[model samples]
Target: MEKTYTRFEHYSGDRTYQNEQLVEQALANSDFDQAATQGKGFCRLLDKAYIFQDEKLSEYSIVIYTLDEPGLLDSAAKREYVLSEHDEMIIHRMAVVRNGQYLDKADDVQIRILDHEEQGGRGFLTNRKKLSLIIKDLHLQDILIFENTLVSHAPQAGLKRDFKHVYQEFPDPFWFYDRYVLRTVNQTSQVMTYKSCFFRDAQHQVIDPIAIDLPIGESYVFEADNFTTDYDPKLEVRPFIDFATKASYSKVSDAAYQIYEKVISQNSTWLETSAPDLLVELAQHETLDEKIRFVIEFVQNSIYYVYDAEIMDGHEPQEPQITYESKQGDCKAKTVLLKSLLDYLDIASTCVLVNYEADYFIPFYCPSPSNFNHVILKIAYQGRHYFVDATSRNQFGFLQYRSVPEFMYYLPIEPQADLQFREPFWHQNYLVEETVTCMVTEGVGQIDHTLLLRRQNADAIRQMFKNESETYLFNCYTTSLYYNMCLTDNFSEKELSEYFTDSKIAIVSDNQDLNELQIQHDVTLLKPYTVRIGKKEYLNYWDRTYLDDKARDFNSRDLPFWLSHAREKLTFELRTDRKINDKEKVTLQECKIDSDFLCYQTTKAVDKHGARMTIDYSVKTNAAIKGEELANYLSSDKKIRDNNFGMTIDLFEQGFFDKLKKSFVKK
Candidate 1:
């Protein structure tokens, strides 16, 4: 006699409706699966031992709506399912949304039972069947529906599927639908992708997949696979990819013409007086740095960054006025505003639309707006093109500072177009300085690290930090050996177990599993340096994950080499400090600890053995640092800020090698 609750309801024609109850008491009984199955069954439970055959319906109908693009709705079909009930009949319906279109056409709209059921008190119905469907033409606004079921005599025809089946039902919104435009340098090509997974029609299930070759100067490929009843299948195939309209590029469309006249081509009254006055005022700011800083700060902190390309409906290239008027724009709007501001200042700037999410160094070369998710301002300063995105606040420096390997940046060549493309190496010179220091106690440590980064692409830096904020929290370490140690306000043992790994013991909070922690890492060094040790084995594990694999790419064995060298020195430092037993004394120095950057100097000191060790590092990368160096530093820094896990960590030996071994030793 257990009570159960149903989140949703299904109904048939008669006054009968399907309900669910939790079998709390049934668990104590002999039959558990039977009770659970009765409450959560998908197929019908036929009484009197009757069997039914699957068959196709007489007719099929479908309706489609194109909400995003025109050719997005061409190839389309529909499907529906019907189920017979004792009192009345019920139809279970489902639809697939793909390529911004709906696949309504179904191939085999039939159902079969797998398990047999005995007519008893909520007897077991061991039958499992699947409904199959196929459709063509998919796009953004695409949605499929069981038209017949919705219009049926039953009260409910709305199709429903469980969370486990969500992927098959719809394409990942984050990975596909949620993505904005990502374009190249010339604005000639672009790429579209989403942030996460979503429900979409599986490829194998798609029947009669068709491609719409647009008059645009582009090619397309459409595909699908695995049509049978394999739920949650990893079946993947390309479907409905098209290039830009060459005809439209040669002769603008009515939409483009209307947009240009309505926004871009029109001369603004503000340009006559207010705009010129603002420009003059900006110039009078005393120095180029001041004016540039003002522009950078204005764009970064003020505008609320949001990608609205998908939501603009039929809107093509956005106008600067509209973006300025709206006070908000996606990547396009923000780019336009920055360009306009630069124009007002009489700065030589170009408006470029590129995919900032891919190929950070290379400019995207495409005419399609679909590939450009970000709009940037390109200014030629001293014979170099500097990329700047106004949608960021934490970003500091030129375009190279914000460039990611996968992001493609697009730039507008002419003064009239929204944005075009550019090259990746346009603005390649930049520098970053980081210093990390820590003081270690028996099982505790304190770290202080600072970043002094310099660059010309201010816009790029702003955006980098916006996404980097979350990543930054988890990128560093309280201790490299105890890299996973979490800092929280509470000391609950449950929270401690959830956040604390065996590598790091966090006692900053009181709720830790002190019993387990004390016992596991109880091995202590005699006195003065009487630090407890936790998992020394993890030191080898750390070296394996970082020093071995990661160092190979750089062709450098410095991490392991430094770790080994540092370990030897630590004994002397510990021994010397233990004998002296002085807490107030501090040591300092300037010396190179590695070969990567010779300018970097390491200053460190050990006081009272396990009580503390401090390090202050400084380095100046070569003036010509570009390409990988620029991209790596920017991306890594942004990643650090974006992760919110509460600690920063790096594989560099100098960054954490000493602290890691000590963390394990003191555990």
Candidate 2:
């Protein structure tokens, strides 16, 4: 089968074409038919790119060939293209090819333009437009090709005016492509370099253009065939793929620092006068830490986050005055405003750029503005450094927000700042202390539960209560008890409310206090603690056995998984009015398993009238578990789960003799 070739170019409103071949290429020549046979339904015939000049002009073209499947035609027929209409970039040409004929007239294709303002954040003020095109007469075995050439110029103003960075991400073959090509045309004065970071099993070959001694320009081509399975369900955590080519100035840090320096200096005058009244009021805090916290909270909670990309120069932040007046800004605007307030307080702070979702791969990429998705402010206070993300609404304390893994690879946008990786402070784990008491009488039990949470745990619970309705929260509590205690469905909302009352949630923000949040739930239910079998009643105490079920499935998994650092303590006290003897005391010897990955212990004690059990479970490691360590952890977890902490109490039933004795005692 001969390869069908179609090429088109448009520059300065002039359209040109070459090699318009109409060869009927066999479906078997590519992997499209095989993927269709396997129910994939459609495949990309060509996903190609061409970067002309530095970041100035680039052309991207895609050709998708759909199978004769019902559901797949709709997806393959319509196409959407997103582009930012900035003075620096222009979409010079957009054309579509159906089968072997090119759509030369405007009416040949159905084109619709829509504002691409994303929800949950402010829309970019720039020319961020979505172009939707519908191809006419699309059919199976017919090829559909769409191409657009974008010419990018240097920003007329701002930090990016001097430097140019170009980034192109090629679609992975996992989308069921038989062949893919990544071509880069570097027509700049600087020498261009290409790095291939494709998946291990991806069959690929790179062809570099002949090197010239002079800066005449060069082109690099990368081609790949077939798709390699890149995901594993067994693995709990995986590193994202860097399947893109970045062309920019050699020094990434230098380029970023230049932008940071320029933006900050330009807005320094406005920063001096643009402090919000709320921020000014918060500035009265006696301690620097308190002031910083107040500023962080103000920027995070007070300002509504909206990404106004037009007013705010892309990655560059708008003036602090504008952010204060708007009371709404994205991460960049919030970070800038927070930094400005900190500067007014004479605190040492720096704006840092980070990729919250893909921080693991940021260190490997060349430093460019496009590398980062989120921005945060770093403050140095009293012989320590605090990385504060003002965009986080629920983060209260200084160290609480830094617990996430993305902070590990954050880059400070400063002129000599080295790439530094941060380690999560293990001591800052959220603490959860739950005390539950159960009192039983006449086959019914009342539960009084109080939870004391600190730091992240407190923030999480508070957020839940604030967002969820009262009924939803009650249902959650009921669900937990139902699953843990194997409770019957005999308890009604009115009966449950008498014993297990509505949760009384209180949050304390005192900086010096030990407990930051408290939630209490008291409930009464029928046969909550006791299960009846025929005429015999058995009392089952709250057991930590349910925690073990999660680890059982991991015994067979060979891949490593993320284990969060945690410190949790649960205590249960059960008291019943049923008569008992001292000799019937049941005690399970305390079991403790301590390792690098996890630390767990449970202690149980039973007496004549009541029983007490306490479980202290903590995850000791912040890294993934694998190899022998994973096996050891799984074995220990199994041991912890296998040790039965449940004890049964037999209630004495009144006999005929007791009835006669009661008749004699009544006189």
Best candidate (score: lDDT) = 2
Tens digits of lDDT, candidate 2, 527-573: 55443666655555545533545555664232344555457778887
Error of 1 at 292 (Å): 2.8
What lDDT does the true structure give each of the candidates? 0.32, 0.58
Worst 10 residues of 1 by lDDT: 158-167
Top candidate on TM-score is 2
RMSD of each: 19.9, 6.7
Instruction: Report the Cα lDDT for residue 547, model 2.
Output: 55
Measured by C-alpha RMSD in angstroms, how accurate is candidate 2? Answer: 6.7
Count the clashes in each prediction: 144, 16
Error of 1 at 273 (Å): 3.0
lDDT of 1: 0.32
